[model samples]
Target chain A: MHNSSRRGFMGKAFGAVAGVGAVGSLVAMKKTWDPLPSVKAAGFTTLDMSIYPEGKLITEKWRGKPIFILRKTKEMIDSQTESQATRDIVVAGIHYMIAIGLCTHLGCIPAYIPAEKEFHCACHGGQFDWSGQVTKTPPPRGLDIPPFKIEGNKMILGEVGPEFQAMKDSGVTL
Target chain B: MAHFTKATSVKDWLNQRLAVEKIEKVMASEYWIPKNINFLWAMGMILAITFALLLVSGIFLLMYYNPDVNLAFDSVNYTIMREVDFGWLWRHVHGVAASVVFLVIYIHMFTGIYYGSYKKGREMIWLSGMLLFVTFSAEAFSGYMLPWGQMSYWAGMVITNIFSLGGLHMDGLVEWIRGDYVPAQAFLTRFFMLHVFLLPLAIMGLIGLHFAALRIPHVNNQDGEEIDFDAEAKKYLDGDKAGSKVMRFANDFMSKDMMVVGIYLIFFFYLVFYNYGFAMDPVNFDPANGLKTPTHIYPEWYFLWSYEILRPFSINIGLMAFGFAQVIFMLLPWLDRSPNAVPASRRGKFKIWFWLLLVDMIVLTAMGKLPPQGIFSTIGLVAALGFIALWIALPFITMNEKKV
Candidate 1:
């Protein structure tokens, strides 16, 4: 009886180790050649937002995700939003309201700070101004907002492109 | 129908005849060989022929093979099973010959090591020989990766990671070795050219230098003694043997080396015909997929122990220890302090360590092949430290024994 049990235990142990080995092998083999997937409609759409004069920011989603657009008024544009919050969002000032939905701290989307012109990440007390710069610390960098181009009357926001340098030169930030 | 005319004049016949005679005379007079050559001296010629065979067969195999990650494994299979005529044979020869060449070199090097072949007069020959071995090793390794198989991919991954130890950021170095962020088509092409052209040329040049250096310092005969041709002949036999100018090539070393060369050729031909080249690792015929690690992953037989050594310890020091062991093995000549070159003279100390090192190497190689766990890994760890211990202890042992 003891011999049989021992044999059974040995068999099970071998099976378990072999199973792990097989899984590892499969995982290793799968990574050798990964063909790039085709682009999806999920990535094709762009966000749209309108900012107010105080470098007031608005957040909205274009491609099923939140975006920050900090529209700066002439006043805020001149001062470049001296508050650390606005200082973070002041990227040439094309889109003033920082609409980037991502939480600067842990990647959870932060709630808006309309009154003080800052983004307060609810998950953490991380703060960012109209410019999207992290005011309250802990977040590594400013929120990532999409690029915007003015299509006649509406500001059309989309993925950043090679023209981002010129956009920044023209007082725009993505 | 075209008609050909026969030779019309005696002058035409004489012109052809003397051309043949002149060719023979040049080969006969100065070029044939030294009369005192022996078996230990034959390795250079054998290595040359082995290298030539590898080069020729390697080039032929390359014609139908692809080195790209996507196509490398398949191309090798395609070449063997379908594409080129007798392509499989060529591939086999290339693969088998690679192992054989290393084996031959090991013996050749041991001959040097054991017989004090690298002592005062032939240090340059030894140096060139070492360089030749290094280049040959590199050539073989680069060629191994060209097949783009599962084993090749992982082998490259595990080997290159050794460079990344010691907080040494080799992101750039890794990229350079791979010829890209990943092993790809570019690496294969470069490796093919290196294996076929550059390395072979380097080998040839080193060989020429090796021979030139050897010629300058006349051949060392057996019994670990230099033959004082002038004094010995003068004392022994009315100076007759000494007076005879270095035996002419026609009746001397040429005849002997030719016989040896014939035997070598017979052996080479037998291997080529009977073995049909050599058995390739089946896994190599499958294309590299980074996601897949084969069940039994090891380097070519030459690098097995070191490969095994590097597997156990995840720590950086283990990797360094492994790499150091390999390079240090080649530095044994300088490492030992036995004073005398011959084994018998330094019998007590040298013989023991020589056997220890040999057994140590064998144990390490065996342990390297086992799954890197249990007794095998423990043995590998012990053997790695043992190499270091032997180097340190040999000197101490020699001193104590001398005092006794």
Candidate 2:
């Protein structure tokens, strides 16, 4: 009985030690991202699609901008080609055309309005319709799609939002 | 005449004030303090003393501090590190002491809950304590932003974003609070003023009121025994054995409290001189640019449980749940019960509840730092549910306990 009791006690202690060790390791490993170093990297690289293939998306950092290079999906290209008002749409989701993922009024990410077939400002209520036309007046002009060239299976896109001339003529870069 | 000509010894000077005969007489006199104090009984004075320390040191800070956002960080650094005599020491003391004050306040309130200090005559004290904690937490949060560090900036954004739940346009409110679109110079300045002046003043006044109300009922002693005596004395018309006499404040309470104070001072100095105030994450040291969102935004440790609660649920539920937890705590006196409000008699039940609370708190804290969607969050949800169950069980268990 004494021996059994000793074994029991030892078993419990071992279990506790194991439990603690497991928890410590789990917590240590669970740190998904390191904030300190990223914050310290005073400058970040910005990527432009000019380097990649058509339909390929690459990430580059000019400062902190998240630039993407997506070769137009066949459906997306077809949808934009079909709509005159949205002919300037750079990319299209199944339900809505994205003029530029960037907002026309203020350079914020706009949400696709699937039901309205428009691009809506997630920040403010600025809206653009299927043709990339500014449906809302606060936006001075239609949204501008950054110029991109498709070469074979790859696509190259500029890092800047749009041509200065196009932005001025449209007066939409507000 | 010959003796008078000689210089007085150190002993002679002390002898007159601390005459053994007088000291002996005072020590022998049977003084009545409430005999029924439970563990919860000790925390009230501790908290009060802490609040007083915070107030005095904060006032000293205000004298050297400038409230302008642009100038606030540098000014604080200068005041603590360079400008004033022992300014570094005192500022570090005050900064560290603030963290300690909050830590003590949390423990004190927990003691109150576990021991049922919220019951009977102690209800007002408990309420006042809760109110003090809420105010103190708010002050700490706003003051944190005054440093204009990376953590402060992001912490401000994260907390302010809570107001934007489900299409609520709180931009106006945010701008009003921030004094700009994002946390900017105006907000920092205003927060500095509030932290150094307005909040501390309000806390001091409240502390005074809380203590005054407590004095009227004498410190509640351990167990229900002392409290029962209070009622019996009141009933029998025995003059004030029930805890109405005022002892010499300096000699009786101060001596004991001083020991605690000394120990605390040592610890406080260590943290200030060695650790400095806990550094905000280095990334937050960058200027607050609204364009960049920090990858992870978490509140200070004290607020983690509530923040964790907000993370797992839908926005609407999370918002409601956030306020709900605080409201539940504020209304705790009515929510929980222990027979006659003394812990000794209710130990078995209170112990269970205390352990349950500890578990819940730890689990919630762990959850708060995790991403909202995952197995970890699921575990967090289970723990939260367990917490709710335990909270609801306190009254039921206490009310049904057999008389000792």
Best by TM-score: 2
Isolated chain A TM-score, each model? 0.56, 0.40
User: What TM-scores do the predictions have?
Assistant: 0.60, 0.62
User: After superposition, which runs of candidate 2 have C-alpha atoms over 4 Å from their true positions?
Assistant: A1-174, B1-32, B35-42, B77-87, B165-167, B228-250, B277-284, B337-339, B344-350, B370-373
Give one digit per residue, the lDDT tens place, for model 2 in A1-174: 999999999999999999999998876644322222333253333223234444333333332223323444454456554334333323222222223444433334445444555666533245676556667633445555444443333334433333333543654332
lDDT of 1 at B48: 77
lDDT of 1 by residue, A63-93 (tens): 4345655566666666763443333333343
Residue-wise C-alpha lDDT for candidate 1, range B1-404, written one tens digit per residue: 54434646765565455655576654554332334446756666677777888878877876777656667777777756577788867776787778888877877886676666666566777788888888888888878887788777666665554454423545455545544434445556666677777887888898888777776554554444555544543443353544442443455555665677678768766776686434367777677755334655667777766665555543355556766766765565555554454533345766677678778877877877665555776788788788668866766655444411
Candidate 2: what lDDT?
Answer: 0.58
- Taking the candidates in order, what DockQ does each have? 0.02, 0.02
TM-score, candidate number 1: 0.60
| lDDT per residue (tens digit) for residues B124-154 in model 2 | 8877877788888888887777656666766
Q: Highest DockQ: which candidate?
A: 2
